[model samples]
Target: MRLVNTFAAAALATGLASAAFAQDPTKVGFIYVGPVGDFGWTYEHDQGRLAVIEEFGDAVETTFVESVPEGADAERVLRQMAQSGHDLIFTTSFGYMNQTMNVAKQFPDVKFEHATGYQRADNVSTYSARFYEGRHVIGLIAGGMTESNIVGYIGSFPIPEVIRGINSAYLAAKSVNPDVQFKVVWSNTWFDPALEADAAKTLIEQGADVLMQHTDSTAPMTIAEEEGIIAFGQASDQSSFGPNAQMTAIMDDWAPYYVSRVQAVMDGTWESTDTWGGIDSGMVAFADFSDKIPADLAEQAKAAADAIAAGELHPFTGPINKQDGSPWLAEGETADDGTLLGMNFYVEGIEGVIPN
Candidate 1:
């Protein structure tokens, strides 16, 4: 029964693609998890949306709805977009995974793309970035610069993606300074500035001298600046929020990928494929190092960044152990795709759960 449904879905997607090809001015739509003015995740995605419009000018038309919550409202908005004749839809949030899948089944004639998710169907594709790569670099700086040796991490969820970043950052920090320790606070919501600011204040009260956040807002950075501690930006270049407190930032560049996918649709070659890019691919990038960072530590971070981009170093190499003291990887070995994709445990140096 499952196989039959899969075949039918594939046939439907193919038919839709054929019809879209036979028409001019392909219609594309986007769904954002936050407001376009958030200056974080959604804002970066909207930049990519603009790039798509500029690239395909007369050949493509695009529309988007911002600040859509991730449950029934998301499904309703997606269905409405499809009903409005959007040939392709891009759902820009991990929480939209199952919602996208459900909507795709209902709108078999439309192609769907989800960001930072693993699930895929005949009409759905998943894409993400090696964001932890940037975290590793920032961790090194945090470890080297912290007089308190306490770093605070503001995370949104305990999922594999967020946990993998926490572990990678911890490993990098421990490698530089054995005394460095991490404090984590999970807020569960992605874009709540008030809640995120309160979490940052709590971490500051706990003696954290360097701050990092996985949540999608500038609140954490602003808090770091107000408290005179160092912080790193996420999803977008947020240094403007904390010029003195921001040591560096990870910027998400999605224009290239967006262009390629749209071109695939134009050329009749669109298919379900998972894309994960790192430093070398320009999908994941770091902002310029700030003068607040120690000159020597900045040099070290840049060297590591160069090595990773040149394919000479990997952030997740072993002999590594989990928090339970069980070996996770052997010496001279690096984590494979499957292991990284399913990562749900903290390394020995970390002191928290991977959160269910």
Candidate 2:
């Protein structure tokens, strides 16, 4: 009797699996690290999610958990989505890397995508934009507009991604205005508005006339407005938050990429691969310059952006050096993807060490 019951249970499970496989719509899920209302990282990613919905309509079912914490809660949420029969899941934060991998292991049939992460599995894929390209543009503007010659940068963490942005910004700024300097402060958390605001005020106090950030909050731009200083936006357009202070914004347009990925899944062509898109690919976009910048400067910034998009320039073009005054890149040379992906050192002339 026990053997007969075991066989019946196995048959029922197989039937259920077959029924699910015959379903028409694909189920996709997203996990976010910050509130969608933040109007920054999460908001841009949410735009992509909405695009997926608009593109697929009834052919796909989508769900998202916003403000999901990075560690244990992330793992739990991902596991639940996999168990709930989600065909694909996008974990949209670097901190969710391990959690995504762990959940992917437990559900071999489900596909997982991670943003700004390096790890991958047979079932996992990673993607990120070359935001350093936009950073370079903003740095050029900052270098041209700053009266104090001191530009401020508020970083979200000490990771390679943040470090690369800082280095790119500094290099661009220095190239344009040799006297320009950078003051960097790490908030250590991605979405802490209070910390971001505080960093902005501190940098301003330290004589920074222009502000930039890798954080996912509008607080820095808001502070820049109140202080009558200039600033740039990150991840999304933030001109509404600081109309007078915001010069330009570095936008991460995930809509195209999201639509493509979902289409691939629907067409049964989806595979785990690493995708690093940039200005040329339309992943990195820049907002229009504010009126605070001179017309010539704005035009120059636009020309630089166009050159970058046209592959006429690279942000890390050498005659560059490490922070310790050692030679890094020779003239007319550019950095490779491998070194840039794992960059951990500051470029020459940038002050301070990268916190671990």
Candidate 3:
């Protein structure tokens, strides 16, 4: 009987240790520049956070602060999360770059991942999707479908990332239809619905038949639907908001990246790495083409997407010119990552001042 009691006590101790281990969950935090319900960038990022939750059921705990401003307030929120013992934090906005860097300096132990930022630190990693690839595909569709030969693009900021997308879209459109004209309007805000809607209306009023946006709001799509024009969804699929108006969406799939990063942290292999994934890496995806697009043009768009994913074609191939008509690339040459990463000016044929 004494021997049996000893075995029971030993088993109880082992169980207790296992229970303690199970109680310690990895705490992860996410900071959003816009509300999760914006149905654009933040919503898609929240979907990735949800993917993390689903990937590691009880092994991880997650929290988020949404609609946080991208200034000092971002730093404060990040500091709070770090102080709260968040093991990993993802800041999902370009404007949060300095704030993320500042917070990372304060907490060297916490890991940070900032989206669309060039800055990096020992504890902070930067990541972004090659959204330009998707832009190229949609541009082909726009070029083929536009009756007015005018395409309007709503820009969020004059940053390189947004500029790259505009240039890519315009280049692709011009390739297919040299007569295509681009009109660009800057909204300056990423998530203001009223401002985005006003921009859309203004562009349409200015004789734009096709509308595209780099901003993170469905207001443009909503306006497109009301005005019976074609538009593309940005960051996330906004088809539900504009079934007829939405030509296709450029989806940012953060699930795979987020899950892998979190797994690295759990396995003690997390490091400061810059990841720029695109259509080939499954980071940039295209939603289904709307029926408004002709079948032949849709096929061409899909083929172009396939070519990009397979690396058989590059969007920034030579014979391209800068905004001032200067030779940017020679024939049979391609633009390297260095130049693409800091693309500040428009390619030839795009007329506008990149607001400082």
lDDT of 1 by residue, 196-230 (tens): 99999999999999999999999999999999999
lDDT of 2 at 152: 91
* Model 2 regions more than 4 Å off: 1-22
If scored against the real structure, what TM-score would every candidate get? Answer: 0.92, 0.93, 0.94
Quantify all predictions' global Cα lDDT against the true fold: 0.88, 0.89, 0.91
The lDDT-based order of candidates, best leading, equals 3, 2, 1
Which residue ranges in model 3 land beyond 4 Å of their true spot? Answer: 1-23
lDDT of 2 by residue, 1-356 (tens): 00111332343346754465465567788899998899999999989989998998867777788888889999998897787767888999999999998889999999999999999999899999999899889989999989999999999889999999999999888878999999999888999999899999999999999999999999999999999999998899999999999999999999999989888888989999999999999999988789888999888889989999999999999999999999999999999988999999999999988898
* Whole-structure CA lDDT of model 1: 0.88
Clashes of 3: 0
Question: Residue 16 of model 3: what lDDT?
Answer: 52
| Alpha-carbon shift of residue 122 in model 1 (angstroms) | 1.5
- Screening candidate 2 with a backbone cut-off below 3 angstroms (N, C-alpha, C), the clashing residue pairs are none
Order of all candidates by TM-score, from best down to worst?
A: 3, 2, 1
